[model samples]
Target: MSQQEHQAHSLKQHWRDIFQQGLQHSQSRYHAEDFEIEMAFYGDLITHYQSQRALALAEVQKKLPQPLVKLWQRANLANYYTRSAATTQIPLLPIYRPQQKASLKHQLWWRSLRFKDEIYKDLMIRLNRHPQLHLKVLQHFLTESYLYLCNDHFMQAVHQRLQQRFAHSSEPAIVVAHSLGTVIAYNFLRANPQFAVQRLITLASPLPYQAMKKSFKQRVARPTSLLGDWYNFCADEDFFATQPLDRAPFNFQPQIINQTIHTFVDKPHEIIGYLQHPQVIRAITLE
Candidate 1:
């Protein structure tokens, strides 16, 4: 790697190490076995995500808007990161079983051998029978959330995962969540309204998609419950960003600050591309 590249990687690794050290220090009272496992899990998570964020950074800089690239660099210099997946705040909702079961027309929405249904059935079949074949890159959160919706047992792990991403801090956090992470952040905030947040920034968020919104209505907290500003950002061609907060469902809380950017990058959906914008940086780190 080039010297510059090596230095950048070293810096990110430094941050990861510091975070791990803090985690270790804070949890020092845990028994040796549990502490070892926690350390291993957090270590792996930071390494995996640091690599992902680095790739995203390179991609963003390659074609980021001329006006925004410098700001992006400044943000990076300050170690600001756009959260890829996250969630929040009432003492989180009690872990209890909901009375309703999966209410699809048929328990198993499949025709005997014909596979006659349209998108929903075809989608489920693919998800159930050929998930390995699909290998979608950004659908892990959806897959896990859906599993929790169907079997109550998965909720514990899902809740823990969401909680772990909260990133405890003294500074006010305006979570800049992108794509699938938007949904997770929304759910987290709604479910944990007692959890404190100063602001919420969602980019290329798919929360507006009707089917997705409907599917999770019962499972998460409503937007109205959150106690912060919700800034929704998206580009016109970002198909995943189906919903804008202003057009949110009636049940959605007061409202959100929604804006759009015209990205010069080929991949408008890239989280870093969205995050590099000056507005996005200010939203996450400044206020």
Candidate 2:
């Protein structure tokens, strides 16, 4: 079907296709120019750290005596920071957090930070255990997914380009976004308050409660003529979509729907794999 079509059955198919298409395009466009250079710089930096770490570890192992060597091993080679939130009484994590269940996948990531002695424990483990592998994860997942969607300039370019596509017609749209696309789609809707969004469907979204609220604080400034329902779908194991934005901060909190999905350990947070679910399919064609 064409972009103009808004049929129930076709809409679901379009949403499914969009999720898969977005991932494919984003992967290639990731290396698009100056931004590509910046990504490359970070990748190289991780590489340099990895090489240096291996050499330094080898040297320390050869020279240090038994007990002293173990102590030195505690020192991080790459010094990569853990992205997980620290479980402290800090102002950042927020005492009034969304009631998102903890993930077993993130048990170590969460435990090392929260309800524990040191968040540094998990950070060090990641840095020390496998610098090369962690670097790859950061390159492919963190920077590629997170930064690509969050960076202001890139989003502006996308926002402008997509605005025409999103709200060009008088008919409403059911935006079914997946993974990083969720962040992009939300911001697009928020930015163009005039756009008539019939319904929003976010799958495997990373848009957390606090951050999303802060980002779209003035979403009601323009007062869109017709803004409708929002349905969010998330898998228990997918840590990215762990928290639902069903709270006060959001001008319109989404109706979050949870489910159990058997995901690949490496790519547990992906949406294309979960598109076959009936609930997810139904969400795209809502009324």
C-alpha RMSD for every candidate:
20.3, 15.6
What are the runs in model 2 whose C-alpha is more than 4 Å off? 1-141, 145-150, 209-226, 251-266
Off by over 4 Å in 1: 1-155, 165-167, 170-172, 214-225, 250-253
Give me the displacement of residue 14 in model 2, in angstroms.
10
lDDT of 2 by residue, 61-156 (tens): 444345433432353211221211111111211112366777897767754433332333344243335544333333332443323433454445
| lDDT comparing candidate 1 with the true structure | 0.44
Model 2 weakest lDDT span, ten residues long: 32-41
Tell me the tens digit of each residue's lDDT in model 1 across 20-67. 333333333322232111110122333333444444544434543444
